[model samples]
Target: MRKADRPLVLDVVGDRVTVEHGADVDVTATGRAALVAQYSRGNVMSRSLLELVRQLDDGGYRCVVVSTCESPEPLVWPGELPAATVVLRRPNLGYDFGSWAVALDRYPAVAALPRVILTNDSMAGPFAPIAPLLEAFDTGHTDVWSLTDSYQLGRHIQSFFVGFRDGVLAEPPFRTFFRKVRVEKEKMDVVHRYEVGLTRTCFGGGYSMSTQFRSNDLGVGAENPTLAGWQQLLAVGFPFVKRTLINDPSTAPGAENAAQVVRRRFGVELSDWL
Candidate 1:
């Protein structure tokens, strides 16, 4: 079948999803909120996932929801979703990266899918930057396009370095991984230092021109450190997009500015999209 004519099947698994073709398959079943709540505590982007699914549904993409949790719940949304969407809850069989690799090996169809868009949450709004990612799939620029957060630098540094040095990151079933790194205060000086010396060596080399706005959510602040790690990664050379504002009660106007900046930079209307 022609590429554009092919069905767009999105699998929303915990932390990631695998897509496949076939108009008969379901996408909503793979994006259940309960399954996501299993991996996260408190308010772990669950609302975001719900919103994302809604946007994708409006955009005319087929979705499927899957549960990788042990005692999976009947994944459901508070409001109505597109009728065309499908939902499925599978028995949670412990499947980490290693196990997932084995499963893909066994199910070649999963690995052989034409396009896949994997995200940790369903509420990622205005995913325009990812347009290139979808294009990459069509052009065969990569086998896997893993969607990542913009504020995670320490994680990216560790993952990328480990993968580059030990070749452990060179496993099968994934070729290109897209990570979004953001900028913040604690790491700004370090990033500037790198920009002066070894900028080209880092991912998305040099600091991002955009600034970040964070909310004063006690939970988010408690969980994520400053963006120093992200700055470091940028200095080293990884391509990333900034997630300007974090939705926290502590920061009110910051969120508004962040939304505006993101909209200006990416031409994505955060209010309209989110």
Candidate 2:
């Protein structure tokens, strides 16, 4: 297929473009892809994010990356994206959720695929090969899955990364919920309505949800975990460590950045995955 180029569709301004990687997506593939929503200050893309894209591409996923530029400069995507991945660039309006909604509405492949992953740049992960995790999730019985779940927000599946089975994707409630997503400028509002809301809606609609790391291992509320606790999350087959556990730019304060702490003590930088 040809390299993705700017197209005149959905909101466009200047050189900003929306593109999907492949012309024909293999909907029957056992391994699924991640619809990544990434944000940047300007034209340049994040190296870590690029590495993540490459890993997803190599891992047999037809990644549909949604790049949202949060700067005055027009989105000039830097570097070469894999031919197997689709990318869309737009103004950062509704944070990650908005980008996800736009990509789902515009890309038919996203809905047609049997297994779909709605994830973002918030985590630095797959320090080791992700093949094992992918194999675990390909079971075909999961209605919804997440690397990790959070109880702090009323037992809702954290929105940073969630898997949608074919049943959920092809249904009306899922489409209606995502399309109706309001663009909330406030981070908390988005968190409440989307991050927490999506999980609840899916469960309420007769869908099941689960997480890799059992919160019981982390204690009730599953909020503050020690360094060993973080390691155990990965030890239990959870892929992609949440960046906030280390240092979150959000107002929430944490003990330490797990990446930095793990590196200082274990000499292994999980974010170094490439």
Candidate 3:
């Protein structure tokens, strides 16, 4: 069968997570966020992640960045990172989860911070100030929240940007999950281990979950995130735009694409990183 048409199967053989057809991710735990992000490349000309870190810092949120790449090399920052930001670069063992583990193992100070955010350089913006967004979530009113929740793979909060308050942040189970996670190399591994795994753990542990963008709640259907969906996300104070639509555009095409429309209609440049 063609690789794409083949089903992915993972079997746990003792300590090794073997896959049917996949590559290995060497998640090296060299170090360890109030707002931790996993950077994919060594040198890139994008200011989106840095911008988010700055915005979060300005809002008085402690921020740490775990810089990494698929290969073990020196990760580069385009500009001077704030002193409050603690950064470590290593091999991309487990994608975001590997980065998360690096942060937890290296920095014990953030191990039990009252609140924390796990995010990555997946999008572009803070098109507007994020203080209001943070204000709403940081008020300690919700146990947890994210910019959005997805029904893909399963009903799980998209891992790009998830915030945790003391309820789950201070719990033993939360840290344990992070500790035991494998350096998963498969896409399904990420979905099952981190995305769905984290959400279920938090919810099952009695922590409430919330999001900034909801289609039904906002009177919008998932017709096309570019149609009015992007605007809706922006209007709700979301700080970034997914790079897939604008920067690479795996889904949209030509002028009809969401990135081009966002630029023409809203004047929001989604390729600030490019």
| lDDT, candidate 2, 39-135, per-residue tens | 7666666555776777767767778778776665544444677777766777666778877877777665566566788888876655556666565
Report the lDDT of model 1 for residue 245.
Answer: 32
Question: For model 1, how many clashes?
Answer: 28
Candidate 3 lDDT by residue in tens digits, 66-183: 6554445444556765556655555445677766665665555565555677787777665667778777677746777887776555567777778877636646777677766665
Which ranges of candidate 2 are over 4 A from the true structure?
A: 1-17, 20-31, 72-80, 220-231, 235-239, 245-260, 264-274
Query: In candidate 1, where is summed lDDT lowest over 10 consecutive residues?
Result: 158-167
- 214: Cα error in model 2, Å: 2.6
Per-residue error for 271 in candidate 3, Å, reads 2.9
Question: Who is ahead in TM-score, 1 or 2?
Answer: 2
Q: Candidate 1, residues 213-238: lDDT per residue as tens digits? A: 22122123322322323233222222
Most accurate candidate by lDDT:
2
TM-score of each: 0.37, 0.78, 0.76
